[model samples]
Target: MQGYILQIQKIKDEDCIVYILTNSSLVKSYRFYGARHSKITQGYKLDFELEHSMTFLPRLVNTMHLGHRWLINRDKLFLWQQFIRLFYEHLKELNDVEEIYFNVLEECALKLDKQNAKRLFIEAYAKILDAEGRLHNCDFCFLCDYEIGDKVALARGFLPSHEHCMNQNGFDKDEIEEFFKTKKSLNLSDETVNRLYNILLDGF
Candidate 1:
C-alpha cells in the first residue's frame, strides 16, 4: 500500500518503530535495520508491504520511496515536515485515521511549494476540519453565542467569537464565512493566513 511516513522512533541498534499513515489507518510497524532494508524517513511517501504477526508489531517490508522529488528543495522539505508533524501529533490517540485525513496530506504533498506552502497548508487544514464535521458553521460567537458583526475572532479549531469577547484580532466575518463556504483563502492576506494557521497550531 501507499503511505506517508509520519514518524520514526529508534529502538535498539538499527531497529526502530515506524509510524505510517496509510490510506485508511495509522499503523505502527517494526523495522529491522539493515543496509538492504528500504530507506525511509518522515514525510516520505512510500509503497510498501506489511507482514502482520500476532506476537509482535507488523513488519515493514519491500519499501519503495515514491514522489520524492519535492524533497530536493530544502524549503519545500521543511514545509512538508511541519505538515506531517501536525498529523502525527493530532492523530496519536486514534487507531483508525480516516481516508480523508490521508488524502489531505497527500494533496498537500502534491501541491505544496516554497511560495504557496502556507496557503495550501491552510486550505488543506480547512478541508480536514470540514471532512471531520468540525468546521464551525454558525454566524454567532462560539463562546458567547451572540450574533457576530463584521469582525470575528477565530479560536483554536476555527471556533468563532466576537472580537471583543475573544480579545483577538481577526478577519471580516463575511469573508471568513465565504472561506468556510468555498474552502478558499486566495483573497486573504499573508498576515490573515498566518493568524488562521496559528489557530490550527493550537490543535485540531
Candidate 2:
C-alpha cells in the first residue's frame, strides 16, 4: 500500500509538533504538543482533501483486509485485541524468543542463526497485525483445521495450517518482505523484546 506522507514541523510553543499530511491531491493537518509533567487529552481532525479517502481502502489495502468485517468496522477493537493475544501465546513457545528475535532484527543487515528463524517469523506476524487497515492474523487459524501447538510454515508470509494450505490462504512474498522491513525499522532491543515477548506469553 502507498503510505501517507507526514510532513512535521515544530510548533511555535516548541512543545508540540504540527504535522501536515499529503496524499494524492489531499492535504490535512493536526497538532500534537505534549503537556508538561502530565499527559495531554488532545483533539484531532483528519482533514483530508477527499472525504472518501478517509474511509475507503486502496487496492492493496483492500487485499490485506482479508474480508474480515471485524477489521472493516472501526469500532470493533476486539479484532485487534484478539490478534495481540494470539501473538503472545505463540511467542511463549519459543526458547530464545526475544534475544533471538529482536536482536537479530536490529541487526538484520547481517545473517542470523536458526534460532533467529522462528523469531523472525513471529515478528512478521506481529507487524501484519499492526498495519493500519488490515486484520491479517486470525483469519486462517480461526477457520482452519489446525491447533495451537501445530508447527506451521509460511508461504509469502501467510502462516497456513500446513504446506497444503498454502495455495488457499497464502500471502505473497512481497508481503513477507514488507513485514520484515517494517519490524526491523522498529529497532527493538534484545531486552525489551524479551520483556514484551514474555509479557505476551504469560498472557498479560
Q: Give the whole-model CA lDDT for all candidates, comma-separated.
A: 0.84, 0.33
lDDT of 2 by residue, 173-204 (tens): 33333544566514554644443344234331
Regions more than 4 Å wrong, model 2: 1-74, 91-124, 127-169, 184-204
In candidate 1, which residue pairs get closer than 3 Å at backbone N, Cα or C atoms, i.e. clash?
A: none
TM-scores vs. true structure, each candidate: 0.92, 0.21
- The window of 10 residues in a row where model 1 has the poorest summed lDDT is 109-118
lDDT of 2: 0.33
Q: How big is the positional error of residue 77 in model 2, measured in Å on the Cα after superposition? A: 2.6
N/CA/C clash count, model 2: 1
